[model samples]
Target: MSDAAIHPTAIVGQHARIGKGVKIGPYCIVGDKVILHDNVELVSHVVIDGNTEVGAGSRIFPFASVGLQPQDLKYHGENSRLVIGERCTIREGATLNPGTEGGGMLTKIGNDCLIMASAHVAHDAIIGNNVIMANYVGIAGHCQVGDNVIFGGNCVVHQFTRVGAHAFIGAHSMVDGDVIPYGMAVGNRAVLTGLNLVGLKRRKFDREEIHKLRAAYRMIFASEGTLRERVEDAAELFKGNALVQDVVAFIAAASDRPILLPRNGPTLD
Candidate 1:
């Protein structure tokens, strides 16, 4: 409290834990149940309420509402939690909600995330580290967004969907299913277009690994066998390839939503 700087117009609850070097700018409101780690910054006109915790060094820009009650009709003041991770930047006008009882009572955003302006993270969404959500992206409730995922502007992900690690959701995509690891999804219905080869290359994945993944992808999506059969065959063929195995395991995982396939592939009912 001694080292923290709070503007005169800011209304921070007395019980709110303010760590050293924290900066609460003018017109900010922080509720009693909030816990701000060291060096956190609220850049004016921000409201953080509920049983929420913001990690160290995270900066929340103007008009961003965090740790608010969930929009779920079933949410009945259950003391659900919202946890934002370290060094993340939550841009202006973003809205983040806490979880409900039906969805583990926790909404968590991992470290180094860039939640762009006007993005919305609905209740119970578990977002992984280094993720990027472009402006106007909306993620519905209970969605699982894996590490290094990138959501382009105006993208909308349906509730309960799972987006795998390093996946890319193109602009204006309406994703309603499970997107596999390193996969690229685009368009209105959001079919799996291909691997996120550009991302892989930028991240320094070697040519041999990319080649193996491409081959496995082709085999798994071929119009020959059932999806389950194709996955099994790919698993056997790319047994030693870790990257391919990641895709295979993501597809094999139990999910309420269907695994997204290529536009030409057989659709899952």
Candidate 2:
């Protein structure tokens, strides 16, 4: 007998691969190509459609529409995929869509992510490990959210935007640009308000590192010749500080979207 404990009311397709100790709750629907890894729990009313593979120990709450078809009109039923990593908690009403062909045919989420209720991760969005998305957060297609980032409730990230590691997007913010590593962005049209000092401290960043990063942040966004020149100057000046280097390197890379800059002036802790 299979080790999986499947509720009688749940509908799991014959071709679906249910790993050991996987539990399918009442009214859950598993598609033909879905793969639930060991210790995965799908609460009642959860739907896993398309070619989706959820990693071990991930618990999904009720009413989540995971790995569904892409909402894009350009999606012509291609064999796209949605891959969720281990220990992810997908809360109620969250919607994660599969990728379109143009966006590499895979929407991937890394380990230990907390996707809160009603958050929507659109087609081909790549979310890194340890990310947190509060209720009603919306990530548009092709957005890249880096590791340990946090998005407050109701924030909407525009298509093709990139939010770097350790960044924070405040509630109700609309991000239409790239957010640099360790940047804290907040506004209707999100601007880099400051460094995520609280987050860095909570993550155990040393005092000196934070101080140096603060210095680098000030120089990078000061009213200078050009953003590119400021970035180069910060890179050279703070080359020894790893955290500052990360932001500098991120700015050096070419992006389809413009990066979010600090609003008004520098904000320091």
Candidate 3:
């Protein structure tokens, strides 16, 4: 702690391990079992508690609460943890809680994430790398958010929901089910809308790959058959593309949660 650039007014617990080049601004309070890796910055008035480990280059803004107690009633004094990776931005007023006993006792946030102001990550949520959670996004307990996912503002994801990689959830939606990789979803009880074509394009996916994914999406969501049959058909038809393979794998790996599907017949194109 002495080697770090900590403000005189801050209260860092003696048991905390503050790495070199870490900066604790005015009025920051850190708990005993916390580890702040190199170049971590607390802007001001940030409260980090419980068993938390923030990796290198992560920054915490004013009034953010990291690694606090779980909101769940079942979390009765277990020594759970919240582990955050490198280069993340925890914006003002964000509340990220540690995990519960039932939810595996670990909440993990991956690298290069931007958790915007007023967003809440509940107990045991596993947010993947490069994820952007807009302001007011609420992620409930045990949600598994995959890499490069984008959550529009004011959206709430239910507990145990699985949002796969490269998926996009539109603004004001409520997701209670599983969203497949690269799929777009938007609604109150969010249904899968289509492939994230704009996202794919922005991320520089090849045109042929996008077309193939679109075709596979249509085949899988076609009306007039069981989801299993449609997925099988799509899998057999588009087995060449790795993107489609990921989608198929996600569909097949779904648990008890309902899979989001396109609401209409052909709204994607």
Clashes of each: 0, 0, 0
TM-score each candidate: 0.97, 0.98, 0.98
In order, candidate lDDTs are: 0.94, 0.93, 0.93
Off by over 4 Å in 2: none
Model 1 lDDT tens row, 51-101: 999999999999999998899999999989999999999999999999999
Clashes of 1: 0
Residue 64 miss distance in model 1 (angstroms): 0.4
The sequence of per-residue lDDT tens digits that candidate 2 reaches over residues 129-211 is: 99999999999999998999999999999998999999999999999999999999999888989999999999999999999
TM-score preference between candidates 1 and 3, better one = 3
lDDT of 2 at 107: 96
- List candidate 3 stretches off by more than 4 Å: none
